[model samples]
Target: MDHHSSHFTQAFIHLDRLTHNMRLLQGLVGIRPLWPAIKANAYGHGAQIVGRHLVGLGYKTFCVAHVSEAIDLADAGLKATFIVLSATLPENSPYLVAYPCEPVVCTVEMVESLAGEAARTGKTISAHLKIDTGMGRVGIHPDAVADFLERCRNYPNVSIKGMMSHFPMADEADKSFSQQQIAQFHRTREVARSYGIRTFHFANSAAIFDLPDAHSDAVRPGISVYGLKPSHVMSNPQVDALQPVLEWKTRITFLKEVPAGTGLSYGHAFRTDRPSLIATIPLGYGDGMSRLLSNKLELLIGGVRCPQVGRICMDQCLVDVTALRGRVKLGDSVVIVGRQGREEITVDDLAQQLGTINYEIVTNIAGRVPRIPVGPSMAGASTESVGDDGTLKTLTER
Candidate 1:
């Protein structure tokens, strides 16, 4: 599809901002390997596209939630080593070996399964062991680390090259808890080292900017690379250096005037007291715009904030533009999450309005929305279409 030749709601990937963020993150992270987490479809920035962008920018390591995500990236012709943060089953051993991925093993059972896969495939595979010092989600319990290590030593083909842990409160204002988690992680690393594990990585998006001590062998940054604070409470000088890489834009497809006391949208959620001009755009909850946003959100049109009226429909939304001095017209560009003329809407802003985090704002954007790369090299880039299930179609590279 010729992006320049059509008009539809689309998300634009700013390649230039992505480059800047990579450099800024690398600089802040020092010489440690920087693995940008591409899980959740690269936080809805389109994993395949972002993977290509990062590869072009000379990035060698990419991180994802599951090994399947890594396979998706590999299928796209991206040449990068992938680190799967989640556990991979023995049934998935072939995929782990077929693709350049290191899956995180968190249990003794997982260790045996992955090792069996490696032995059967006649290969030595690098895998990461996650320790649950504090984050009670996934990982070998601190008490079980000793036994888990012994199991790994039994299988020489399965090398434990990396040890990592997640920080549940790294983005919080208080550093005491995060400090404790890091300390616990360091102790676990020492115990594992007696058995030969060396690589250590703990810093997530929040820690990459807030916790320098966690910046061990590698730093995995997810949200900050897209220029949104990990949480409202987290910020630093280096955090400001990152840039937003996505912009959601759509053109007004319909407009109309309503008399006083007229209700708008489904269930008449928004009713006008005075005369009003309402504008409608072809974007709705189906596009991943949360239905929860209903009457509580605002969109930018002609550089002004237009209150979203009524409940957002499945394929359309109504915005109140009655406050504008001039008449509201059709075919105007509406900014759902980006800049418009002199004003800008941010992921943080949208997240705040919806009572969520920046991560949800970007990742929730459905894959059906096509992604177009904007910046240098874009002329040679092909527009990408994401499946309803987040399957990224191949981009016709020039």
Candidate 2:
């Protein structure tokens, strides 16, 4: 918990880069409010750090995957409007009413429960109506939007503040399906607006980059806000301007010279063909470094790419630092997904190697790893820890 003490691995969150990404996205959306998606711990960039910084930057609203995620941030003193993005049962009405959250509504039972709770508690609950244009997810059908709105109107204490939909394939190279979804949402938006819905949002991170027309009333930019491309097929060249906000780093803990024919780590997955200098960093699958990366992953040390030889263990892994030989030493910096001198390793690089998306590469990072805030704005900011429950604790004061 000591800020000055050595850490096995630390995720350096660049607050300045987050601001840059927001500005670039703001340019794309004009004056429309960007309700950043801070769910899954801001795509594992540390939501408390990201949420607190964004609150300081004047962002009033955020989108989260569940009511509990919003409650976690609210409990951490983040004062913002959290639009709960998932459909939930009526059982969670009390927590939803207690917190400053707008639950996305797709069923009448949920709305009735919210209305009952709001009336009983002497409060008015604001919610968003979800129409399943084509996502085929948990939303009312487009044809049922009018009747749903009418039924919701019966509950005067429950206000339908917005109408929303999602895009299933907006990131694809061919966006014919996305365009059709947009048209379908547009029709429902028109009908919902007539019923006094103030906001009609239909854009996700992919739609923000490729579908300008889908940027209805407000845009929910998720992965882009954290500087990860929604997908490789985005048609806009402007998305390239976004900067990544997280850098995963660790330190060299031990070093040894292994002769030819020497095996490394568990199961002897990698065997040395020649004398090799092997360095062990206190990182492995326990820290979200996938075992699948065993013999294929490369880490950066001394500005050079070093292959991670052998099976990655649960608590440690071996990096062949043969190139650095005498140059590398104990406590030397190692880059997991960051820049070391001129060489850079990004989440996209890891995703490509693992045959997964960038989102998984970050969110998979275990909560045990400390996320240290670092940037021009974070000069005096404190280091924080994300607990297993997803609550963030400040380790030190500014």
Candidate 3:
């Protein structure tokens, strides 16, 4: 079977914009290592593509959510140090030891298990000690940092190279809780320092913008690295400079004219007030376009903003393209989240409509939609051109 057949939707991963965002964040941290979070499949932007590009850009370290994710990237030849971010069980110690993964530790059993695995494999496993400064989620209590460090000394094979914490409300307009967290982290920093822990990382995407003091020894930036603000309330105006790296696009698959008073789609959720030209695009809730967005969203066709009418289906949605009746055609490019001429629809717009955050909007993009890497680096490489001009270019295999 031809896997590429009938696949109309794509998320264009702009490597240039990704590099720009990384450079912008790096400038703020200044020589401090910036460990870009490639977890959740690089926030659903295709981890393989994003990891490869970042590796080429001289990023020697990356943060992933799990040891398996790190293994997958490493197996794909992404040479880098993988810092596993989430808390895991003693059962996962073997995989962690087998791979180049440094997991964040919050429990004694996990540490002992890792030590056992490292001893058995004759390899030293470097790990980070997570302190629950204020997040109230994972990690040990702040007061227990010294004891944890002391206990960790028993496991010679399990080296605690770093100490870290997370901020719960760093993106909010109010910084009181974050400030307290940072203060608490400072006290724990002394403990880590006494224990000879060299790296102490605490800054995330929002903290990178609003909490300069929390920049610690290294920074782990997630959303900001993908050119997205942590929240609308970040204090730094420089957050606005981060360029979006992903653009979702599809093509007109089918079209027809409907007379006035005609009810369209399932449940008749929408009815034509006047004669309208309806265009079908191969995108739906199944493709990560929420069904709640039915008749509540707009797509770009021939640089014109066309209202998406009717109920969104599992594999298709209808766009009322009457405005572009004379200009649009079958296979014409449709901008789902990107610029078309002077008009644009952003991920933020979709999030607002869905009563969600930009992170959800981007990360929720379905897996089937192929991510095509683009930018100056990809200029001469094979790629498909599905533009509004209706010119079809053959898609090159990755």
Each prediction's whole-model lDDT (CA)? 0.82, 0.89, 0.88
Between candidates 1 and 2, which one is better according to lDDT? 2
Measured by TM-score, how close is model 2 to the native structure? 0.96
Give a tens-digit lDDT track for model 2, residues 59-143. Answer: 9899999999999889978889999999899999999999999999999999999999999999998999888888887898999
Per-prediction TM-score to the true structure, in the order listed: 0.93, 0.96, 0.94
lDDT of 1: 0.82
Predicted candidate 3 versus true structure: per-residue lDDT over 323-363, tens digit per residue: 88888889999999999999999999999999999889888
Error of 1 at 174 (Å): 0.4
Residue 294 deviation, candidate 3, in Å? 1.0
Error of 3 at 12 (Å): 0.2
CA shift at 241, candidate 1, in angstroms? 2.3
The candidate that wins on lDDT is 2
C-alpha displacement of 49 in model 2, angstroms? 0.3
lDDT of 1 at 36: 93
Rank candidates, TM-score, best first.
Answer: 2, 3, 1
Where in model 3 is the C-alpha error above 4 Å?
A: 378-398
Clashing pairs in 1: none
